[model samples]
Each structure stands twice: as structure tokens, then as C-alpha cells.
Target: MGWFGDDSDEAEAYKQVMQRPQELSRWSNQLLGDAAAYEAGKAYEDHVAANGHPDEHHQAKEILAGVIGDFVDREVEVQGLDFIDRDWAKRHAQRRAEIELYDQHGDRW
Candidate 1:
């Protein structure tokens, strides 16, 4: 758990590595919930405004998450934080986007 490992396995000598989800957080900080998050939320809100809210808010959240996730991956690499897990970063970005959407739009979306 302390040391990190991808989804790989082999002989027992190396010891079975534990996949820690929490540790997957390489960018689950304000770096996500900050400016980029605002933009992502705004974009999703605009989408909802134009197309109307999805039948399920989770769908909108998923849309926001995907956009933020892409942004996170590109920005992390651009900022030279390649050690972070892209998927993990994306998941965190999604969470922030969902919160932002809720704060901005409330139950309307």
C-alpha cells in the first residue's frame, strides 16, 4: 500500500502489491477545485442551459468530469506533474465539477 504498483502480478518474491485507491490521489487538491474547475462547471452549465438539463444530474456530472479530466491530464503533464494518475486526477476533477455545478445551479440541474 505504501509503495505504488500498477495492475501487475508475478512471482511471490516481490510480494503482492496493494492497489490503494486513496493513494491514487496525485492531484485531489485545490489544484483541481480551483480556476480550471470553475471553467469546467461553467461549460457544463452552459451545455445544460442550451440543451436543457439531463434527465439525470449524474449525466451532467459525468460530462463535466470528462471535460475536467481531460483538462487535468493535459495540465498536469504541461505543469510537469506526470507522476499523477490521469484517471485519478480526472475523478477528482469530476467531483469538484459536480460541487461547482451544484453550487451554481442548485437543484435546477
Candidate 2:
């Protein structure tokens, strides 16, 4: 387990999100616009062409399309912009503790 009791895949994903708040904010802003729809369409076309099995490709495309649609439609607000604030400080402390744990054990847990 991580220092923050983050042993599951969901916890790990949340940790990654906490680590890249700025990047996530930027990407979320981009995804909120029409560019993401265009890119998702192109990516789906490319994936369909690259995959060999037609049935599998279609299923995968459906799943990918749903995910892209959800991301585009969802409202994303970037919080904790102030580094000196209590919330930001707490999150930074937790992330630092996780990093220290990783440095000590190197994912052995």
C-alpha cells in the first residue's frame, strides 16, 4: 500500500490526477471544446483501420466513442490553484509522502 492508503487502481489513478492538476486543467479545457470531438473521430477511424477483427474493432470503437463523449460533456473545474492554500498544502504533503514511500521501497508493496 502507498503511504496514503492508495493500494487500488482507482487510488493510483486519483494520485496521478493529483500529481498533474495543471495539465489536467489544460486538457480538460481543451476537451470541453469541439477540437476533442474532431480528434476522437479521427482516432476512431485510425483505430478501425489498424485493427484486424471487424467485430472487435467495432466494439472498441463504441467504447472509445462513449468515453470521448462523456469527457466532452462533463464539467471540469480546476481547483486549488493557490499553492500556499491549506488544501494545496495538504495535497502536496500527501503527494510528497507518496513519493518518499516510492523512493524508499520502489513499488515493492
Q: Largest TM-score belongs to which candidate?
A: 1
Q: How close is every model to the real structure, measured as TM-score?
A: 0.55, 0.27
lDDT of 2 by residue, 61-85 (tens): 4544554444333323244333223
lDDT of 1 at 62: 75
In model 1, the Cα lDDT at residue 18 comes to 16
lDDT (0-100) at residue 6 of candidate 2?
A: 39
lDDT of each: 0.52, 0.38
- Mark the regions of model 2 whose C-alpha exceeds 4 Å error after superposition: 1-33, 56-61, 66-109
Off by over 4 Å in 1: 1-29, 83-88
Q: Candidate 1 lDDT (Cα, whole model)?
A: 0.52
Clash count list over all predictions: 0, 0
21: Cα error in model 2, Å: 17
Q: Model 1: how far is 58 from its true place, Å?
A: 1.5
Residue 104, model 2: Cα distance from true site in angstroms? 53
